[model samples]
Target: MTTYPGMPAAPKKSVLPTIAIACLVIGVLVTGFFVYRIVVTVPGTPQPIEAGMVHLEKEGLTIYASVPVLTPACEAQDASGNDVPLKGPTGSETITINDDTWYVVARSTQPVPAGDYSISCTDDETSATYAAGPKSSVVAFVLSILGAVFSFLIFVGLGATLLTVGAVRKRRGNRPTNTFPGPPGAPSNYSQQPPTTPQQSNTFPAPPPYNPGPNPDRPQDR
Candidate 1:
């Protein structure tokens, strides 16, 4: 149960892979949302009217009883059933669809004939304008899908990374490791001393007393 001082702790299984997986999921979701928003329309929303009838009053003036639909996702057509590009003086005019609403558009290139002009209205649910036009709703839709995909990918990546790191740590933990000698073991390569034999001291016999010359001198004196 003891942990080594320098050993790294096992990584928890709750990180990296989770983040990556989240990102991937978020990305896909955002993409799907974008697709959906581009398709459906809500009633009573400000939609464009095409081929709208215009009542001409003067040489240079044409008054459209109902303004042409110029918003993205809706298509505008002329009275002749031709696609009408929301342009000219009335192109950007804001006209309500109510019975009392009226829009004034003017043109200088051609003299207005004093007559009644009729235009038609049609809704194109698959118009490219919704996908690429400045007012297209696809941008928001796409972002939602992307966000979801990214989140999912992030989760996956974080989870995988955490799992891998934890597994490696566990493997190392179970392996036998070289241990440094501490209090329980002797130091490596310790040497022991061998016993030796005791040495004996030799004693020579005492030399005879040195009394020859001294005895002769004493005798002469006596």
Candidate 2:
């Protein structure tokens, strides 16, 4: 029987292949999740938002505001406290204020011009901050559940792989019953019995010196 010396062969692996596989799996999962969100959770279509119009009244430099104390309200006023005719269109539009755009309510009037003009809307100004509907909430819950499942699968896979490798090593008679050297109470530097065969020294062999010219005693005029 022949025996091989040196470390055991490690499982074959390639950096590019592993990375590509991981990226592909991640891309597929992410694309599926996003598609699900867009189709099911997100609102299918936006309905028209109604707006109640209030004619502006001139009073001093600022308009004395009077809005209903009930449903969503939007205040429209100008610098000179004059009523500015607005289309009051519903559904979504951008209004500029001081060169900065502010996305007001779809049901509200457009923003006022520069100067002392300012319009306030009940709708949130931040586009990212949306009033999530029930469908969106349910979608979030589903995503959370999926995330948990994926995490569990990864952890379980890793643990099972490690356990299987350990079992195989044990069957091959290489498992360590004790990884530490000697008894627990023994000092770390405690010497042990030397190997039966003496170890070969690692010192380098001596080299012969170089003679540049002929020996002085041998030369001398030939």
Candidate 3:
């Protein structure tokens, strides 16, 4: 095989594409998991709240409950059948039962006013009413969606980076290397040089002196 003297070797194959593909798959899985958590209720034995009226002995009562995707509308009522709005504190807490996770929905700082009262929650989507207790909130659902979108975008960016690197490597691998040209009139494997010629001498040999015979007019002159 003919080889160029100063040619660089072809680039090695790149693993970036493989790594990018893995990242994409992982990102998809993570996004799907977060989306599922947002929509589905935590799995466990259901805890049913009492059907009758509940009395709040203290001003600040923390409510905990499990709910689906949408946040529920909740209220408290006094014995006089007057509706009271419940206040929710910021942040939430998680509860685990048999390895299943649940979220605290609301907490109130104001006093309930010692009296016969009832708490109820209505689903925002279905408008179904239930005894007020604990349920998932809008915050959890929004957070889950945000997390999923962020994770997916990050992974996609990584994959794009890897793909770009792989393409660059492939292009380099296929590129032609610089080559040195062979000498003129030389064999394929040999280097050629200019031919050398001998120099001529400047001096020449002297000719012998000229000799003449006796002329006819001077015959007999001996």
Candidate 4:
């Protein structure tokens, strides 16, 4: 097919919509996974303390420990057995499972270096110092959840923008190109037909009879 020199080529199909859809699907899947982790995977059975000492490690700024009952005080120590002052609880909550009660604890604002650590708690009722068992960090879990939420929002926003742009382009591509003549009263460049002249009627005068009278007077006797 011949293309005019200045005429625009047909618009190509947009890839933006496909990319947007892919992003949306991926974002939803990732968001769902993070939500599942926050809701179902984060909480775990509390480890019991033994012998006034528990060995553990820190993944973030703080470490957490849970106990069966309320304790008067708690503290942590480095692997070298140096006493580290326990930061105030970032979070503490009571949870019950199978008729047993547990206190979930989180550490303070200062981040602890990631490594082995020991936890010790003092019982208020018995004045006994006890060691806690290996446990997970609540602060790390909470941070993970927040990070996931932020990522999900970004993915959704990007996907929505791409989809909107693609849809607008597609609509423009589908619109019909106008090639018809202008309205009846509009002026045109073509030459106009000349006006017709009116036809005239034919008329003629009658001829006179031949005259031989002068010569007829002498020739009439013969």
Model 2 Cα lDDT, one tens digit per residue, 18-94: 44456556655755665554455432222112223222222111111122122234454455666543333233433
Give per-residue CA lDDT, model 3, range 1-222, as digits (tens): 465665655456678989999999998899999989766433223233355476544333345455422445666676789866565545555555687555555545454555456666555565322333323345566688888899899998898888998988788778664355566764554545689898999988998888877777886855
Q: Sort by TM-score, best first: what order?
A: 4, 3, 1, 2
State the lDDT of candidate 4 residue by residue for 73-182, as single tens digits.
Answer: 76777678877655454446544446654555445345456565666565556533233333345566687698679769988888999999988888888876644344
lDDT of 3 at 48: 33
lDDT of 1: 0.42
Q: By lDDT, who's the top model here?
A: 3
On TM-score, the candidate that comes out on top is 4
Better of 1 and 2 by TM-score: 1
Q: Where does model 1 exceed 4 Å of error?
A: 1-136, 178-222
Provide C-alpha RMSD values for all models, in order.
15.7, 23.5, 12.6, 8.5
Q: Ten residues in a row with the worst lDDT in model 4?
A: 127-136
Ranking by lDDT: 3, 4, 1, 2
What are the runs in model 4 whose C-alpha is more than 4 Å off? 1-46, 60-71, 90-101, 104-110, 113-118, 124-154, 157-161, 180-222
Relative to the true structure, candidate 3 has a C-alpha RMSD (angstroms) of 12.6
Give the residue spans of candidate 2 off by over 4 A.
1-136, 174-222
Regions of model 3 farther than 4 Å from truth: 1-10, 41-134, 179-222
Better of 1 and 4 by TM-score: 4
